[model samples]
Target chain A: MTVPAAAAAGYSLLVLAAVVAPAVVLESAGDRGGVRGAVGADLIGVSAAVGVPAAVLAWRGVRRTTRAGRSRTDVWIAASCGLVTVAVAASALPTVVLHATTGLPVLDADAGWPVPALWAVCLGAAVVAGEASRRGVLRWLAG
Target chain B: MPALNRRQFLAASLGAVGSVAAGTGLGSQLWPLMGREDLVPGRTPELVLPAGAWSPAADRLTFAAVGDTGSGGRQAMAVADRMARGYQDSPYGLVTHLGDLCYYGSVEDRFDDVFTRPMRPLIDAGVAFELAIGNHDGALHHSDASLAEIDAELRLLGTPARHYTTSHGPVDFFYLDSSTPGLFGDDASVQLEWLDDALASSTNQWKVVCMHHPVYSSGAHGSTPGADELLEPLLADRRVDLVLSGHDHHYERTHPVDGVTYVVSGGGCKTTPVRPGRFTAAASSTLQYLHVDVVGDRLTGRSVRADGRVVDRFELRAREGR
Candidate 1:
C-alpha cells in the first residue's frame, strides 16, 4: 500500500516537472503556438515513457496488499492513486493527436467539442483504471 | 471514526485562508515584473529638419515606417496612436512594416492580437501596409506546416508575395523577404539577381528598398554581414535614395555609404539601448516610427516617438542625372 502511494506521488511530481514545467516556460516566452505545439507533443511522449513503469509497480503493490488481506479503504486509496496517474497520462493523448493531425499548438478558446471530448477521455481512463485495479484484474495481469 | 475537533476545523480553515492570501499577495507583487522591463519616463532628443528641404517641383509622397510592432501591447498602441495623429495632419497612404509582424508568426490566432488589433486605427483609415518578412514573422526554423500557415496568414494580411515591389507616387518601393534561407544564407544569388534587375529597371526618381535585416545598425543585433556584402553594391550602383530595415528594435540613421542612406526604424513597439557606430549619424532606443515625405528630388524623414516627439530628422537628395 505504502509503495503504491509513494509511486503515485512520485509519478505526479515527475509529470509536473517533465511536462507542465516546460509548457509554462514556453507560454511565458510568448503566446505563439510553435514552441507550445512542439512541447505539447513532446509531453505526450514523456508521459508514455514514465507511465508504463509506474502502472506496473502500482499493480504489483496492489497484488501484494490484497493477498495480505489489507482493509478495503487501504486498497481503495491505492487504486485511486493509480487511477490519478493514468488520468494524467491519458489527458495528454488528445493534445498529441490534435498537434500531430493539425499543427495547432494550443487550441483556440472557442474549440468546443474537442476540449470537452478530451476531458471526457481523461475521466473515463481514471474510472476504468480504478475499477480494474480494485477488481484485482491488474494484479492478475502482474502475476 | 473520530470527528474533527472544533480547534482542528478552525485551524484548518485559517490555514487555507492564510495560504490563499499569501499566494495572492506574492502573485500581485511579481505579476508586473514578469516579461517586462522597468521603463523610465524621459524625453528623447528631437532631430532637426532642415528648412526648405522639400523640393517644390516633385509631387509629395508621404508614408509611415516602423518595425517589431506586432506585440499589440500598450506601447504598440501608443505608437499607433501617434501614427494615426501624424496621418491626420499629413495624410499618408502607406504603412511600411519592417517585420516581426506577430510574435511566432506560426500561430494564426496571434495575427488578430499582434497585428490587427494594435494597427486597427491605421487599417480602418484605409492606410495600406507592406511587409518585409522578419525572423519572427514566419516559422523559418519550425516545421513545414507551420511555415505554410504563417505564409498564408501573411498573404491574408496583404503581403502580395515574399519578394516584390510596389510603386507609390515618386517612390519605387522594393520589399525583400530577407527571412528566407536563400536570401539570408549562402545561396542569395537568386534574390540578388532579381534585386539588381529591379533597381536598374525602376523609372521612379526616388528608389527605396526595404528588408527585415538591417545592413548597418548600432543596436543590439548590430549589422548583418551577408546582407551588407550582397545588397550594398546593387544599392550603390543604382544610387538608391534610402534603404529601410528593422531587426535591432531601435531607430538609427547611417551616414551615406556610396551615395546610399541606410536607416533602421525598428523601434515600433519595443526598445533597447543603442550606441552610434562609425556609419551611424544618429541613434536612439526610443519607440518610434519614421514619417517620411518625398517631394520630388528631396526626401525628408522625421523619426517620431510614441509620445509624439520627433527624435531624428534627415533629408536625402536624388543625385543629378539618373
Candidate 2:
C-alpha cells in the first residue's frame, strides 16, 4: 500500500529539516558569529513550517493553469514534474552548504554534545511542524 | 496480479534473483569510489586504535609511540610491559620514540638494561624501534664522548641514522632532530632543506612527522623554542597527517590546526600537569603511550594508559578525499 499523500509530504518536510539543520550548525564550525546567528534566526522561522504550505500552494497553482497530459509525448507534463523534483532536491541544500564551506565529519566524539543535540532539536521541530502544516494544508484543500 | 504458467514464473524468479545479487555486488564495489557529495556526506566508523585491546590486521600499518621514558624505573617498565602486551595482542612493526632514553643523562652505559631489557618482548619479535634525539640522548653537548655515546646508542638500538624517513604500508614517517641548533640555529639549514625536500618528494598516502619536541603543547615545556617559527608551518603546508612528539611528560592531543593533528605522548615514565588549551582536544597527566593504525586514507590513534584505559581517541583523514 502507498503512504498517504499528506503523510508523505510531512515526512519529506521532516527529512528536509534533518538535512538543513546540521548543515547550518556545521557551517558555523563552532565559531558562530553575528551573521551566523542572524542566519539561524531566519532558518528557525523557515524550518518551523518546513515549507509544505508554500509547496502545496505552488503545486496547486500550476495544476490549475496547465492542461493535463494525455499521452507519453507531453513535454509540458515532464516540465511540471521536473519543477517539483527540483524543489524536493533543493531541500537538501544544508549538506551542500556544509560540503562547500567545511570538512568536519558528520559525527565525531570530540565535537562535544551541542551539535548532535541541535540536530535532535531540529528533528523534533520537523516532526511537529511538518505534521501540523501537512494537516492544515489538507484541511484547506478540502475546504 | 495475473496468473502465470510454471515456466514463466520460474523465469521471472531467476531474473529477480539475478537482479538482486547484481545490485548488492555493485553497491559494495561502488561505495568506495563515491566521494563526498552535496547530498550525502561520506562517513566511516571510528576505530579505537590497537591499544583499545584490539589487534590490527596484517594489511594495515600500525605503530606505537611513548616519550620521556628515560628513568628506567618502575613506571618505565610498566609502560614497556604494556607496550609488549599490545605487541603480543597484535604485533606492530615499529615504536617511534622521540627521546630521553636514559635519565642518567647518558645513553651508552645503560643502553641494555635501561632500554633493551624493558622492551625485550617487542625486540625479540623483530619489531623495529625508530629513534629521534631527545634532550638526554647524549646530544646534550658536543663533548668528546657525545659522538661516540650517540653512535653506540644508535648502533645498539639498531637505528643507525638521525633525521631520516621510513615508509610502511601506506604511511611515511619523517623523523626530525628537534633539538636546539639542529632545528633552528645557524647550522640548521641543511636539515631544514632536507626535510622540506623530503616532504615535497614523498608519495605516501599518509605523511607523519616525528620529533622530540612538539610544535604545540600545553605542558610545562610547551612547544620547542622555535618550533612554531621554523617547523609548524612547514608540516602544515606539507599536509602532514600527524605530528608525534614527546618531552612534555603528559598525553595531550591538539585540535587540528591546518589539517594536522599534533600529539604529545610524554607520559612514558613520568607524569606532568597539562592544561587544555582552546586548541587542545584532550589532555591527561598519566603514564600512557599512543597506538596508531593507518589503513587506506584514514589514520586512527588512541592514547592508552598502562592500565589499558584509553585516555583520548582521534582520527585524521587524508585531504585527497580518497
Candidate 3:
C-alpha cells in the first residue's frame, strides 16, 4: 500500500518520539503492574502519543523534502536508516556493555519492560515507518 | 548509488542483519539487556533504620500496612490521601509496605513518584516507611542487576537486610525476603535461619512476620512453597502470632493455622478478582489498607478502604505463652 511521502517522514520521526515518550514517562514515573516482561499497555500508549505527532511531522517533513526536489524513495531510505540504527543499537549495546561490566549479559527479571520495551517499541516504530515510507506513495507531498 | 543513498542502504542492510540475528535467536536472548545496563545502579548502602522508642508493656503500637502501591496513579494517590486522613484521625507512627513498592521495575529516579510522592503526607508527618521487597522490586529475577535492585530498594527504604527484625513498641517485627521462587531454596538461603533465631529471641509480647509473599494465601499468588514446610514450624514453634504479606492484589485473612494468622493485604493501588479459600477468614477484591493496633495483650486489625469504610475487622489476643 502506498503512503503519502509527508506521512512517511512524520512516521519516521515517530521512531524517535516513541522512545522519547517512554523515557519521559520512566524519568517522570516508573511503576508497572504485576505482569512480567514488556508491558503491552505501555506500548499501546506510546503508539498513540507518537502516532499523532508522527502524522503531523510526516506531512511537514515530506512536504519539505518534496519542495526540495526529493523523491518518495529518499523518504523511504531515510526511514529505513533510522529504523536500522535504532534496532541495531537496541539489540547490541546492552549485551556488549553488560557482559563487559558485570561479566554476564544478565537478563534478570528486574530488567522487565523498561529495557526490552524500549527496543521493541523502536523496532515496531521502525517497521511501521518503513512500511509507511513506501517508494510508490502518492505525490501528496510533491511540490 | 549516491553517497547518501549508499549510507541509507548500509543502514538498511545493518537493520536486516539485526532482524536476522533476532530471528535466529542470538539477539532474542540478548533482548533482556535492552538498555544501558551500566546505567542501572548497583550501589547498595547500609541503611538499617533505628527503631523508635516505645515500651510494649506501657505504650500501644499502631501502624498501617499496604502493598502493590507503586503505580503512583490516582488509585495510589487515593489510598495515600486516605492514609493521610487516617493518620490525621489516629496518627499512626509507622507505615509498613508489603512490597512491590516500585512497579514496572522503576529505576531509582522514580522512587519519589512511586513511593515518596504518593506517601508524602505520611512521610512528612514523621511516619516511618518500612518495606518488604516484592517481585517487581527486583526480587523475582536472578542477576547481578537484580541484586543491585534489591540493594537499591533496601537503601531507599532503609531496611536492615534481606531479612531482619525490628521493633515497634511491644511488637517485634520479623521481615522476610520471600520474593524469590523458593522460600528456602535461595542459592545460599539463610533467611529462614535468621527468622528462626529472631523469633526465638524476641522479648516483645507480639511477634509479627512481614513479607512480600504470603505464608498462606488463596489469591492470585497462593501460599509460597516451603512457607509451610520451612517457615511454618519456626513461626508455630516460636508462637509467631501474625504473618503479614502482600502480592495477591487483594485482601485476605486466613483462619488461624496452628495458632498463627496469615493475612494478605495487597490492595494498595489495584485490585483483581479473588475468591476465598477454605482457610480465608475474610477476603475482598478492593483497594484498601490494613490498620492494625497492638495494645498490651490484644491486636486489632481493620481492613479499611479509601472511603473510610472498614471492610473487615479481626482481633487477636497475645499468644498465651509469649
Q: Judged by TM-score, which candidate is best?
A: 3
* Tens digits of lDDT, candidate 3, B76-192: 655676777776666678888898887544538568656776776566567888888788888576468877887898898888787777898878888777866425455524667
lDDT for A77 (candidate 3): 51
Q: List the residue pairs that clash in candidate 3.
A: A6-A58, A10-A58, A32-B103, A32-B104, B56-B170
Residue B317 deviation, candidate 2, in Å? Answer: 0.8
Better of 1 and 2 by lDDT: 1
Q: Write the per-residue lDDT of candidate 2 for residues B139-256, one digit (tens) a residue.
A: 6554657667767767877775768898877888898877766676777889999999999999878888988888999998887777888887888889888999998888999888
Q: Write the per-residue lDDT of candidate 1 for residues B1-322, one digit (tens) a residue.
A: 4453453344334444644653453244322222122111111112222222223233668898988876654355557767777876677778888878765234476566566656665676677889888877765653577477657656767678778898988888999878657486555778888988998899888888899889999888888866677778888988888999998878999999998899999877666668999999998877789999888788899998766778899988986558
Each candidate: how many clashes? 0, 0, 5
True contacts kept of 2: 0.01
Model 3 off-target regions past 4 Å?
A1-143, B1-57, B186-189
Give me the iRMSD of candidate 3, please. Answer: 11.8
Deviation in Å, model 2, residue A111 alpha carbon? 49
Q: What is the lDDT of residue A13 in candidate 3?
A: 63
Q: Which ten residues in a row are the worst by lDDT in model 3 chain B?
A: B36-45
Interface DockQ of each model: 0.03, 0.02, 0.13
Docking class of 3: incorrect
